[model samples]
Target: MAEHKDYYALEMKIDQMIDELQGLCSQNGLSNTAAEEVVVTSVFLYKFLSDKYMHNIEKFAEEIGESVDEVLANENDELDAFYDAYPTDVVFHSTDTIQALINKSGQPGFAAMFDDTLERISNYQENDKFKVSTAGGEKEPLFTRITENIIDKSKRDAFAVAIFGIISESKFDFSDAFGGNFDFYSTIFEYLIKNYNVASGTYAEYFTPQSVSSIISKILVGMSQVDDNKLYDVLDCAAGSGSLVLHLANELGHGKFGNRARVYAQDVSTKSTRFLRLNMMLNGLTESLDNIVQGDSLTSPSQYNVNHDPSSGYKKFDYITINPPFKMDFSATRDEIESNWQDTDRFFAGVPKIPKKKKESMAIYLLFIQNVLWALKDNGRAAIVCPTGFLTAQSRIEKKIRQRLIDENWLKGVVSMPSNIFANTGTNVSVLFIDKTKGDDDKVILIDASKLGEKRKEGKNQRTVLRDNEINQIIDTFINQKAEDDFSVLVSTKDIKKKNYSFSAGQYFEVKIEYVEMTEDEFNQKLSGYVSDISRLWNEGHQMEAEIKKDLGGLIYERK
Candidate 1:
C-alpha cells in the first residue's frame, strides 16, 4: 500500500522508451505515430515476457529437456525464437542481434520478427511451471498491421534500438513492483493507451479514467458483497479496453473470482478487443481472456445471455458496470434492433431517433441503459456512467427511463459528478446505480458530487480528479442512504415522480434559510439612513414648489 515507486519508475522508463522511438522514427523515414505506439506497446510486452521467463528459466529449461547453458545458447529453436535467440541476460543485452537481423532481411524481416514474437506470446498456454496468459491471438497479429510499404531500414533499426534500450533500463524491475498485490503490468497497459495514439478506426476505444472506474467498481463490488456465496455474474456490454471490467475483477477477487464469477465483455473494435485480452492476462485472470468478445454489444447480444439459455435468448447478470460510448451511429442496425427487441423491454423506454445530420451524438447510452436493466438479475445491481443530463432531462426517452426505474423500484441512487470527469470530453457524467432487490424502499439516494473533484490540468483541458477518500465518501453516503446537507439527499419515489422523474439531488436538497440577529446599534444605523433619505426628498419637493410659484408670479405680466 506504500507509494508505487517502482511502478511509477517503470512507467517513466516506458515513456522515455516511447520518446526514444519517436525521436528515432522522426530521424528515419517513418513518422507514423500509430506504428510507433504499436512498437512501444509490443516492446513492453516483450520485456514483460522476458522478465517472466528470466524469473523461472531453470524450470523452463527442465521442461524443454535442455541444459541451462544450451537453453541460454539458443537450443532447438522451434517455438519462441526470440526466447531461444537471446538468453535471459542477453535478450536485452544489446541491439546487435536485432541490427543484424535488419541488415540481413530489411524492414519486412524485422516486422516479421515482431509478428512472430507477438503471436507466440499471445498463444502461449498455461503450464504448472509458469501460469502466464497470451493476448494477440483473437485478432490479426499486431505485426501484420505494419508493412514494408510504410517501413524501411532506418525506421526498423531505430525501433529495435529504442526497444532494446528501454528493456535494458536498470529501473525496469517487475520483482519489486509485483512482489505485493500491486498490478504493475496493468498500469503499464494503461500508460500505453494514455500516452499513445490508439484512436485509429471509426470508434476509438476511450478508457474510463481510473478515478471514475474505481468508484464504480468499489460500489458495485461492495453492493454485490451482500451475498458472497452466491456467484455473481458481472458484465460490461461496452467494455472499451476492458479497464472497467478489469478493475471490477481486481476488486471482486482477482483469480479467485475467475472461478466462481463469470466476467463478460464485448466491444466493436477488434484492436481494443485484443488489447482487452492482454489486459486480462496481465492482471492474472488468464481465464478471463476468453470471456471478452469482439463485436457490437448492442447488435450482437450473444454474450449477454446470463443463464446461457438460448430459449430465453436474453441474459441477466448479478452485477453490471459500463461506460458505454456517448454518441455512436447505430443507424445501420437500429431498425433491426427496434423490430427484434420491441417486445423484449430492452428498448421499452424508446430508441433514439437517427438524426439526418451529425448522427454521431445519437443516444447510444440510452440503449445501453435499457440493456443493463434487462440483463440485470432480479436482485442484481448495476453501476453505469451516463451524461448528467440523463438524470433530469425532460425528453421523452429520458423521462420514460427515469419513470421506469422509479416505478419498478430499481432506482438505487444517482451520483452527479463534476464536468470534465472524463478528460477527453466536456460533457458532465453521473453514475446511475440500480438495485432490483429493493424491499419496498421508495426513497432513492442522490449525491451531488459535482463540486467534489480536485481541479487539475490534464494536457490542454482541465479535469476534475477525485481522490480515493472522496470516492469512498460518495459510495458510503449512497450505501448508508445518508442525506448530508448540500452533498446528498434521500428523496421519495413519489417526490421524484412529482418533479417529473428528476433524479438530480440538487433539485431536492433543502435550502437552509439562516436568520441573522441584528444588534441595537446596527438597527439604529440602518433606520437613521432611511430617515435622512426621506428628509432630503421632502426638502427637495418644497424647494421645487417655491421655485414654480416665483416663476408663475414673474410670468403673470407677460401672459396678460
Candidate 2:
C-alpha cells in the first residue's frame, strides 16, 4: 500500500492525548500507556487510507464519545466508559507501544483479511443471496444469512464516497440493508488480525467481518423455531466481528436455548477475538460475549483456555452453525490432532491422512465436518455452507464420512444452489443439513435450485435470490420429502451408499439441458463444402508427388 503521509500528523495528535489521559488515569490505577494506544489506533483509523479503518472512522470516534485526543486525556476512572464507547474489545497495556506501532501497519490482526475464516464471513453475502430459496410456496431469506463490513469511523464519509464512485452505475440493497449506507461495516473494528491479508479470492469489498447485529438475528430465528429451542449455539469458529453472536443475543425474545445455546465463538486471530468482544459490548450483547472465547476451533482447543472442549469435556450443543474457511491445509497438525483428539471429539472417527504436498486437497472443511459432528448432541442439527465440490467430488474419505453418518446419524438433505451462489469466490456453495436425530423419516431430501430468482440490481456482478414459491419448494422437499420431477428427490441412505455415496443430483435426477436446433439444410450444405475442399487438396498433393518422383528418376539417370 502507498503509505499515507498525513498519518504522521494524526498519530502525533493521539500520542499527545494519550499522555494527558495517562496522567489523569494514574490516580484511578489506569495505565496512561493503554490510553495512548487507543489514541494511536483511533488516529491511524482516521488518517490512514485503509479499507479496514477508513470506512468506520467516524463511527468509532462517535461511539467512544470523544475524539482520539479526548480519550487520551481521560483518567483510569474513564476506562470502562471509554471501552463502552468504542465498538471493539482490544486490551492495551500502558507499556505496549509496540502494539501501537503494529496497528499502524494497517494489517489485519489475523486470518489475513483474505484467510478462509474471513472468507467464510465474506461468502455469506453471496450465500445469503443464493439462500433466498423456496420453502412451501413462501418467500423467506433462507437461514437469514446477513453480511456486514465494519471499519474504524474516520473513513466512513470518505469510504462511502469511494464506494459511491465504484458503484456509480450500480445500486445497493438498502431495503434489506440495516442502514442506508453500504459502508456500515467499515466502522466495526480497528484491530488487524495478527496474520490477515487481503486475498484475490475475497468477495467482500474489504477486510471487515460481516456485521454482528445482522447475523445474530438470523441465528435467533433458527433457535426460536416453535418447537424445541435447545439447538441454537450461536457458534462461530472464525467469528470475525462477533456479528452473529451479538445479533443473536439481541434477537432473543425471552429465555432461549434454556440458556443452553450460549454464543460459542473462536478465532485464531486475537484481533478478531478482541473485536468480537467490543462489538458484542457495543451491541449490548456483552453478557453473552463473556461466553464467547478465542481459539482455533479447527485445531485442538487452545492450550490457554483448557477448561472447555467440543471434543470431550464441554457441554454438547443442540444447534451449530459456522462459516469456517473452506479448503484450508492442516497436514502439519494432523498427528497432533489425532493424539489429543477430544473424547466427545468432533473428529471422533479421525480423518484420512493426506500427503503433505497435496494437503490443500485435504480440504480443511473436512475437519470442520468431523468437528461439528462431535460438537452436536443426539438431538442436535447443523446447517452449513459446502462447496459444490462436496456434492460432485468422489473420494474414499468423503464416502466414509457420509457412510458413518448414514449408518449412524441423520444426514438429512442437500440444497443445490445457482452458479453465482458465491460468485465472489470460485466455488459455488450448497447447504449441507445434518440432523443428529431424525425428525420422523430416515430418508434424505434434495432440492436443485440452480435457477432461483432475478439477478439483484445492486450487484449486477452476480446473482439474485428466490421468490416465495421457489423458497416453498425447498421447505416442501425437506418437509414432505417429495420429488419434483427434475428439481427435487428424496432418497434413502442405503440407496445413496449403493451408488457409492454419490450426491450429485444431475446423476440421480435428469436435469433439463436446453439445446439449440440447427436446420438440416444448413448442416448438409456446410458438410458438403468441407468434403469438396478436402478432395481438391488431395488431388493437388498427388500431382506434387508425381513431379517429385520424376525429378528423382532424372537425377539417377544423369548420375549413371
Candidate 3:
C-alpha cells in the first residue's frame, strides 16, 4: 500500500464525481426518476470510497493511478471489499496509523476471514429465509436494499425476505452479494431473509415495508409520553417479518425503559418468525430474541400464551403493536385459535363466529383485536394497524366487535393513515390506538393522515413518513384533542352512535382546505334549522305511511 492523501482531497474527488454526474444528467434532460437513481448510486459509491480511503488518501491516489475513472473501472465484485477496507469511524484519524492498527489488531483479518467463511457456513440457507438474532444485532442493517427502486415479483420476494433477514441474521447478505443492484424497496425480502436465517422454525408472511414501518414507529414514539416503561411485555400480534417489534426495541432505545420494557413479537408465518429473530439481532435487540415468537393471531396460539401466561407470573409486554394481514378471512375457523381464545379460560366476553375460510374472512383482524386485548396488561396501550374495514364495516359482525371493545373500555382513539400506506397491499388501513385502561371514557380522537405522505412507487405503499414533528402533531391532537375542520375530530360516544358507529376516519374527517367561515351562533342556527327540517320530514313520512296503510286496509275490506 502507499501513503494516504488528506481527507479533504478525497472528499473533493467524490464531490467532483457528483457534480459531473449532475451536469451530465442535466445536459441529457434526465427525469427526476433517472436523476435520483444517479444521485443515490453516486452517494453509495462515495460512501464506499470514504470508508475505504478515509485515512489512507495515498492508497486512493495509488489505486486511482492516472485517474479516478481508471480506478473505478477496475472495481467489480472486489469493490465491496475495498469499501469494507476501513470502518468509517476509524477514518476520522490518520490513515497510516489506522492501517498499522488494522494489520496489528487482527480485526481486518477476522472480518476478511468471516467474509470468506460465511459462504461455507451459509450453504444450507436459501434465498428467502428469515431468521432471528440476539439483542446485539445491527440497528442499521448490513446489505439491505430498502431504498432500492425496483418492484417486480422476484424483487418483491427478495425485498420481502430481506426485510425479515436483517432483523434475525437468518439471511447473510446473499441478495446483497447476488441480487442485481436495483433500487425500489428499502430492502429485498428474499435476500435479507436468507442472509439472516437464525430462526428456530419457518412461514406465515414476508416482511412489512418501510411505509408501514414509519407509521408504526411514529405511533410508538408518540405513545412514549405515556410510555409505560414497565410494560415490558411488548407484542406485535401481526408481527410480519418481525421488523415492527424489533423497531420498538430500537425506537425505545437501550435503557429508555430499562430492563422492564421487553418485547414479545409473534407472526403466523415461519419465515416471518425467523426474520423477527434475525431483526432482533440485526437491530441489536437480541435480549428480546427469546421473547420473539411465531403464532397465528387469528387461528393458532404459541407456547408463550398457553405455557407462559403473564397472569401466572410470566412477564409479558406492557405495549402491544400489530400490523396484521389486512382483509384476511379467518371467520370460519375462529374456534381454531385454542391457545388464543377457544380455551374458554382465555376467551373474553365477546368474540364473533369463526369464518369458514382462513384465507377470505376478516376473522384474522378480529382475532388480532381480541388477542391484543387479552395480551395487554390492565393499563397497556396498544397501537395496532388494521384496515378501514375494521373501522367502517356496517355488518352485525363488525358492530358486535366494536361494541365488545367499547363495552370493555379497551377501545381508545383511532389514527387514520393515508391511502397506499402499505405501498404493497394497497388496502386502506388505519392505526387503532387502544388503551387497555380507559382514559376519558366518552370520546375517541380520530386523525386523518391521508395527506401526509409523498407518492410511493412500490405497490400501494405511499410515503407519508411521520418524522418526529408530524408524529408530535398527531400525538398532541390525541392528547389535547379539539376537532380541526379538515384533519382531526374529537367525536363523543353519542356522535359515534349518531354516525352509526362507523370509525372510518375519512367519513368523519377530511383534508378539504375550504374554509366555511361563520360565527358559533350562526353555525348553531344552521344546524338547528337542518335538524328541524329533518324532524318535519320524519313526521311527514310517518303520516304518509299511515295514510297509505289506511287506504290499503279499506280497499282490502271493500273487496272482502
Candidate 4:
C-alpha cells in the first residue's frame, strides 16, 4: 500500500513538472510549435538527469559515510577518487548542480548560465554515449541551447529562472523509479508527448498504442527462456517514442537481465528521436542511447555503420519490432533505394512503384518490412504492425512479400487486431510475426482478434482497447498454437501458398453448414404458410399498380 501511494505521488510530481515546463514555453509565446516541444521536453529531461545524478551522489555519499553537502565540499582529488571508485553513467560537476544554479538565479545572464550548465553536463567526457547521431555523420548532444528558442531575448532570463525555481522547489528524487516497471514509465512518457504526437497533415509521430505494444512484446517473447549470459539485440526501425522497443526490452527481463539486451532505434523525425532518447534515460536503458539514430531508416540506416564498415551490410539482430509509417511521400528516395541497393538484397521482395499521382500514398511500410527480414538473424524473430489489408492483398508488392515469407519458411504467425486499435487513425492493423528458423512443416498461428476490445473515446477519435484477459487469451492461444473456433487457426506454409499467400485468419477459417430435421407434416405446413403470405402480397401489389396508373393518368404533361 505504501508503495502504491509513493508511486502515485511520484507520478503526480512528474506530471506537474511537465505542465510547468509547458506553461513556461507558453508564457514565452512558444506554445504548440516545434520549438515548444523541444524546449519542454529538453528542460524536463534536464531536470530528470539532474535528479538522477543527485540520486547517485546521495548513494555514493551514504557509502562513504558523509552527508551530501560534505561530499560536495570535498577537494577535487577526493571527489575524483570517489567517482573512480563508484562509477556512474551520468557525471555532473559541482557547478552543474541545480542547487548551484539556484544560487545564481538572480544574477545577470541567468539563461546563459543555465544553458551553459546543461551543455557542460551533456558534453561530459564520460557521458559521450548519451549523444544521438544524425544521418550526415554528425552526433547531436543530449542538451542544446533551449533558451535560444525564446524569440524575446529580454524574457529568456526569467524563463530560465522559472524553470530552475520549478526544479529546485520540487526536489524530485527518482531513486525509487530506477527499476520501475513498463506501465509506470509508459504512462508518463505517453502523457509527456501527447500534445506533440497528434497526426498533422502529412507527417505524424505514429505513436503505437500501449495495448498493441504489449501484445507484440508478449507474442514475440513467447515461451523463450531468457539466457542470462546471452546478449540480445532488439531493433525498432520506425520506433516512435520508443514504445515498441521499450516494451520488448521489459519483456526480455530489463529489470532482471539488466542491459542484457541492447535496443537500436531509427526514425526520420528529430522530435521522435529526442523523445526516444528521453524515454531511454527514463526507463534505465541509458546504455542504448547511443544506438538511437535520428535519420531516415529506409534511406540511410545509420545503425548499420555503428562499429562496422558500411560495406559489410546491415547488422542482424536477435529480435526486431516495428510499426512503420503505412504511407508517405518516399518518392524522393524510392528510386535511389532501387537503383543503389538492388543487388544488396535489402528489398528482396521489391519496392513499391512510384505512382505518377499521389506519391504520398506510396506504401513505405513495404520497404520497412523487407528491411526487417534482411536484418533478422537466422534464428531471430520479429513482429511488425502492418495494414490488415496487406495480409489479403491479391497481387503486387504486398502479395509478393507474403509469398516470400511463406516460401522462405520464415512466416511464424499473424494477429489481425481490432478496428480503431490506434486512437489517431482508424486503419485496421495486423501484427506479422516472422521467425527465420521455422521449419517447412511448422504450422503458422493466425489470430482474428478483431472482435475483442471495448470502444472508448480518445479525444475526438474512438479507439478499441483490449482488456487484460482478452490480451492474455490472444497471447496464450498464439504461444500454445491453439486453434480456437472462428478466432484462430494453425495452418502450414503449403496451405498458405495454395490460398495465394494470404495471411488473413478469416481466409483459413472453416465455413460451417447447419442442418435440421423436420417431419413431413411440419414442412408442408410451413410451405403452405409461406405460399399464403406470397399470394396476399401479390394481390396487394396488383391493386397498388392499378392505383398508380390511375394517378399517372390524372397528371397531364405540360410543354414549356
Model 4 Cα lDDT, one tens digit per residue, 1-560: 11366777888888888898888788889988888988888877777776766777788789878888888888586578666864536777778877678999999999999888888887888778888888887888888998988888999999899888777745675667666666888888888888988657322355788888988998888846668778798999989888999999988874354676799999998878888988888887877887888899787888876664366556888999999989888888889999878878888778888899999899999999999998888889999999999999875788889988988888889999999988766789999999887765568999999999999876677889999899999999998899999999999988998998889999999999997799999999999999999999999999999999887777754321
> Ten consecutive residues with minimal summed lDDT in candidate 1?
126-135
- Model 1 shows how many backbone clashes? 2
Candidate-wise lDDT, in order: 0.69, 0.49, 0.51, 0.84
Residue pairs of candidate 1 with colliding backbone atoms: 122-135, 306-315
C-alpha-based local distance difference test score of model 2: 0.49
Structural similarity to truth (TM-score) of each candidate: 0.78, 0.52, 0.54, 0.93
lDDT of 3 at 515: 77
Best of the candidates, lDDT: 4
Two-way TM-score contest, 1 vs 3, winner: 1
| Candidate with better lDDT, 1 vs 2 | 1
Output the TM-score of candidate 1. Answer: 0.78
Q: Which stretches of candidate 1 lie over 4 Å from their true place?
A: 6-8, 29-32, 58-114, 119-150, 153-162, 168-177, 180-186, 197-205, 226-231, 254-261, 305-307, 515-560
- Report the Cα lDDT for residue 175, model 4: 67
Mark the regions of model 2 whose C-alpha exceeds 4 Å error after superposition. Answer: 1-197, 205-232, 242-253, 256-261, 302-312, 342-345, 352-361, 453-482, 510-560
